[model samples]
Target: MLAFSKLTKSQASYLFSFGIVFIIYLISYIISPFTSNDTPFYTLIGRSILQDHVLPYKYIFDHKPFFSFVLYGVWDALMPIKTGMFTLLALCCAAGAATVASSIWKTNRFLVFFILITTGAAFKMLSGNTGVLQIFFQILVLYLLQYPSFLRIILSGVITAFAVNINYLTAECLSLPIIFLLYHNKKIIFNIFFFIFGVFSGLFILFSPYLYSDPLALIEYFQQQKQFLAAYSPSFTTRLFTVIKLFCYVLFFIPVLYVWVQQNIFQKQERIDPNSILLGLWFVSGLIASCISGYPFEYYYILWFFPITIMIAQIIKKPEKNFKWFFMPIAILTLFSVVDSTINNIIKYRNIHAIDYVKMASLTKGGSVLNIRALQTHFYMADLKNFDPYLFKEHIDIAFGSRAAAHYMHDLEQKPLSVLLPYQGCEIGAVEATVCHYLHENYQKIYEVKIVKLSGKIDHFSFELYKRKSGA
Candidate 1:
């Protein structure tokens, strides 16, 4: 403890920020390494790129954009499959926390504490999606506020554009904020021209390799992405729940917004320009995108977590009146949400327990395995193949009637030797059940594995092993 005193305030704060982030990740992922479908899907995509020497459109599903698969390729090259992904995910979360902490240091020293807490809680909902890295990039856009130069402005555009490759929604959320900045600035054309140049160069640098590797696949990817978006139609209840979730986020910031108004408008103490309104618009755009996008996956919340947290932090540092009313209640709610989500995720994934991944590996030893919404990651971990490219629900939707489903069904024409029907429901509302029924008739179920909770409760799910029947 005496040795700790030797460090300066900034040094100590850095250590604290990193320690909090590290602990958050370590505890969250101790048992359940695979957090979401994204982890396996991306890993499988990376492996497909490595083995096939092409992008992963054939073996796995990916719709983000061109450069996303490129990063997965880099991920594949740098690390082993399962363990590597878990470690990388932890590192990304830590990096995001570190980025936010570092960004807050110059503005308000104490803000790092709130930033870490908020980011940790908010990020828990993601379960380590590309959102972690994307949030870090969004944080970089905030830091651009400090060194507002021609160079920095240009770099900001580049960074923002580059972030789109990570996830296209970021561009949707941030583009308006960039326009707002340019409009607010004294020089418009200068910033716009340089910003456009930087953005073009960055896009070229990021996207060129993907085009060179497989332009046709890249074109098909965008087409599929559009089709998926056009096809998505969530339930009215689902949309209502999503709006409520976004409102909860907005509610969490009520105190901060109140404080900002009191300080800037009522008190007239500070002139925190364009950025004051800038980050607000950025946050709003993200929420708008999340709401309107038809699919309301919770991780979409990660898009604006940085800007909103940073804005709240800035206001929290200097409030006109007692802000505990806001902080304490929101703090309690955020903490509860964090813990609750974390626990549910643990229980949800707990059934994916360590009870013989090798047994399933032996079942799918040689040929490509169709995951059937089961342990797709486990199959990838076993170094077996997922021959069917249609692993996602969207693909299942497209398969029912659309021509787009042909790409996915193309490989299935051969009827692979092994199949895994893991979920008990086997309920693909729109996906043609006849296709699955055909498999049942043609194949013989050789083995079964039940997925039961630690409390001795069966999840009503079983992982079945199937082998093809002899030649008819």
Candidate 2:
């Protein structure tokens, strides 16, 4: 306690902020460690990359760029598979808390407290996706650019490059340098040169494996990425509705918009704060980036959490009399939403717990298992290996069409072990037509159990395990 007393106020504030954030993350991890499919998928890829010492896409399949896997790879290297993800989660929250605390520690103490708590709650909803690292690096880049220096500007570019590699959706943040370049008056030319140089250097380092090991592979990767996007791109109506639906999730920003109207219009301030402009730009860019995919996954909204939190903090620091009425109710509602979502996620993932790994392992005899629209955690827990390249089932039919389905059927012919399928109303006929046909002909259903689903038409669905028939 004497050592604690010796620390400065800012230092104490940072520790307190970190403690709150880390504890929130810890509780979320304990109740629902794997909140979404993304957690197990990314963690499994990370584990494979660390153990095999090669990029994992060649073995497993994922369209996410390389750096997120690299971060996970490093995390998985230091700890065992089951718990390594929690350590990463803890570290990410710690890093995010430090970033938040460092940026606002000297400002209004209440604002600092508010941002830290909200950011912690927001991070809990990330569910260990690449968005976790991607958003962190993007926020760090913005923080660095918030006060540009010779080194800080260059570092910002490099960090943004890392963010882009972690998740290509972060490319929207690349425009942020333009905002800084306009505001920065000193050594503009040198800043431009340095930023570009840093970006190139970061890219070179990230792609070095393909650069040196197999140059042709880089070209192939881009081609594959292009084809993948083209295959899955939704129509205009889908994208439009998606944008409208997601916008409702961010109504807390109405207060920020209200503040902006007051400052720019009602009061007619001679000069607007550049930092306000910067924050607004970053928030809008994140929204645009998320909209580009057209898949209405709620996890994508994780990008909005930090910027919105900071904007609200700015409001609270010097709130207007009328702004309080708007902000307080919205803040309360947002808090309720965060708590409600966390509870729902915990309940949703608890359903995945119905998969009994001991029975699965016994049924498969520790052999390769083909999982179709099933939880990936089963493979990770059972230490099972997959012989086929089509490890990922999503978009396989859309992206690769008949050929991919044919290949999956061909793998079923080998029939190394059990086949796991989502039990849709106990009628295998209703599932993917081609695969359903093959499974019925070749495999015999051994077990089926009810699995709860939170966000679908039915509250419960069945999960089934199938073993290959003898002499067939």
State, as a TM-score between 0 and 1, how close model 1 is to the true structure. 0.81
lDDT of 2: 0.65
Worst lDDT window (10 residues) for model 2?
104-113
Give each model a TM-score.
0.81, 0.82
Q: Model 1, clash count? A: 0
Screening candidate 1 with a backbone cut-off below 3 angstroms (N, C-alpha, C), the clashing residue pairs are none
Tell me, by TM-score, which candidate is best.
Answer: 2
User: Worst ten-residue run, lDDT, model 1?
Assistant: 423-432
Model 1, stretches more than 4 Å misplaced?
1-26, 76-105, 108-126, 145-154, 233-237, 319-321, 373-375, 398-413, 423-433, 453-461
| Per-residue C-alpha lDDT of model 1 across residues 217-308, encoded as one tens digit per residue | 66777777777655555778888988887787667767766676566445555565555666667777777767765555667876666555
lDDT of 2 at 422: 71
